[model samples]
Target: MPIDRLADLADAATAPRLVVKVGSSLLVGPGGTVRGEWLDSLVRELAQARARGQEVIVVSSGAIALGAARLGLAKGGRGSLADAQAAAAVGQIALASLWAERLAAHDIPAAQLLVTLEDLEDRRRYLNAAATLARLLKAGAIPVINENDSVATAEIRFGDNDRLAARVAQAASAHAIVLLSDVDGLYDRDPKDPAAQRLARVEGVTDEVHAMATGASSSGMGSGGMTSKLQAAEIAERAGIALAIVNGTHTAPLARGLSGEGIGTLFLPRRRDGARKAWLGGRQRMHGVLVVDPGCAAALGRGGSLLATGITAVEGDFGRGDPVAVRDGDGRTLAQGLAEYTAAEIERIKGRRSEEIEALLGYAPRAAVIHRDQLVLL
Candidate 1:
């Protein structure tokens, strides 16, 4: 069936978990100063959301802008990567301090989190980060998360934050994601067009929807434009998480938008898999390929582990923990999994039974080439 239309966010009031992403435009003003009044009002609404039994997680972008201002750096464009990192190191303290102070006014405790792409790319680290966020929420503290720009390069960028927020929503098990944007909602044409109109609802972020988004953010203070927000909606939708792209300039926008009033474009969730499995399947980077015989391919199809005996060949110099693609003897991609052993190690055990693995390597890391838990068939 064709994706017809999305339901309004009217039910957002009852969602148990809400992840709100505020861009630098909403957090910083001219001269790189923090928007204290705006932040305070937003936090008040967040506090009220908590009182109404909602767990609000904020993904904010402003460290670089605020940092550049503090360091007396040039405006309008970013400096070298190292210079940006240095600015981030200094600016993060100020950002955290501001959020802490503002949330404190409502007697709400806030936890500061700094993360990079690697944190979500690696499975073990992903689990650890997810657990910490879950724990913080359980303790009734709102997590104020931002990219660790001090060390990240292209990964923690402005255009990336929108997608990062979507991943955070999935990892944290958020029921909804709200992207507070410079614009109220998506439009069918260039927003500058006199006839251009905002789209109030989006069913699925198909290729057609993406083509509607054009132009980069012209705001020197921000990078997340309509294109990035649409990309974010695609990610959030597949994770079965509702997302809203609403203007952030208004006071208490979070509260008003969540109550399902007509404010911005709301992209409803489309659950694909259990959150962890979906992350593993869609987010991880593959380093190599493991070619197996038909017997092994059939086993995987039957939901069995990938055994050394079934593997016909191992290609690449990947480490034990690196992700790899699994292929059948016919050279068709079968699945993807984290290698239990290095590519060199797998070379030695190819076509050997699980029992022979210990003798071949002198150390057996279980029997499966890739444990069932770590494998996801394509």
Candidate 2:
């Protein structure tokens, strides 16, 4: 597909609410130096978008890279976990300041948010983060978001900002996402090969698409590669959000891409409604699973809530309001929803009538194990 066929970015038809991710290679130079001129150009474009009534959020990655430079660590070197944490601690402030300084030049307010994986996984925290971003956009402020690497461990961290940007798109209910990367876009083969061809548009990310992913970024300053971008593309597809990968090696990449230069790969969204349902369905991990009987499954299929009487068993320890998979006796995942009761509470009350719940745990109970409004059938 030709890039010119797409609507202009300044036109809301293209993307009313957009999230642009700038990688370390594009924002930070050797010796941890900030790329001021490059950022200035990007900011100019973003400011223009805002003036035209388009809301924009920037998910940036460069704190660790800059911190490594400040600590005198070699480029692309992430020492021990502790060392990386320390570097983040130092670099985050610098990264935030750099963004603020650049954005201020355009009379744009910059807001910084450091998020951990748990922030988006926990239901309450996720809502809070979403609300915060929405409010910032409402106030005409551009948020500069990043993963909270200083306190996040390997187990609870989004190792790269690509996936984090996708999560941000979900949180903000963004129309589109743009990843300003070192490479222009996904290629049919290794980008280094002269015969390689860049794909202009992708409807979905499949196994063959995954196979086309090359390797970790060669820049050494960033952790994400083609694989990470594809993972992000999958998330965006499920969430009904279009995503594009454009080269950020030069200034005004966003403008250049929107100018119909055929410079990037654009992944069209699969669906646009039910953003919340898409989010629940796209979750890669669930805290627990609830296995219901056939009768319960039938009731759920009929748009009914999951009553305790229908649940036969529960697996995994999870707190109230945590996401859980709903399965039937056949072990087929029927849906995913927020649980009303703790795993232990559910275990004690399984198979009991909803009205009899007062006696089972000595307290009045809610109507269902999972409410129809909260559930997303898979």
Best candidate (score: lDDT):
2
Count of clashing residue pairs in every prediction: 1, 0
In candidate 2, what are the lDDT values of residues 1-378, reduced to their tens digit?
212223444466557898999999999988788888998899898988888878999999998888888888663438778778888898999999998988898888999999998888766788899999999999889999999988999778878899899988998988888899998899999999999999988888878998999768979878899999998887787777888888898888888776656578888865553767766665656899999999989989998998899899999999998899999998888889999999999999999987789988898898788988888776
Residue 346 accuracy (lDDT) in model 1: 91
Error of 2 at 303 (Å): 9.5
Error of 1 at 312 (Å): 16
How far does residue 105 in candidate 1 sit from its true spot (Å)?
Answer: 0.5
What C-alpha lDDT values do all the predictions have?
A: 0.79, 0.85
Please provide, for model 1 over 1-378, each residue's C-alpha lDDT reduced to its tens digit, 9 standing for 90 to 100: 222222233234446788889888889888898888888889888887788677889998888888888998876226677777877888889999888988888888989988887887777787888899999999989899998888886743434578789878888988778888877788888888989888888877776788889757756577667888877776677667778888788887765555535567778655565665667665635789999988889999999999988888888899987889999878887788788899999999989987878888898557687998888765
RMSD of each: 5.3, 4.3
Span of 10 residues, lowest total lDDT, candidate 2: 1-10
Per-candidate TM-score against the hidden true structure: 0.76, 0.80
lDDT of 1 at 167: 79
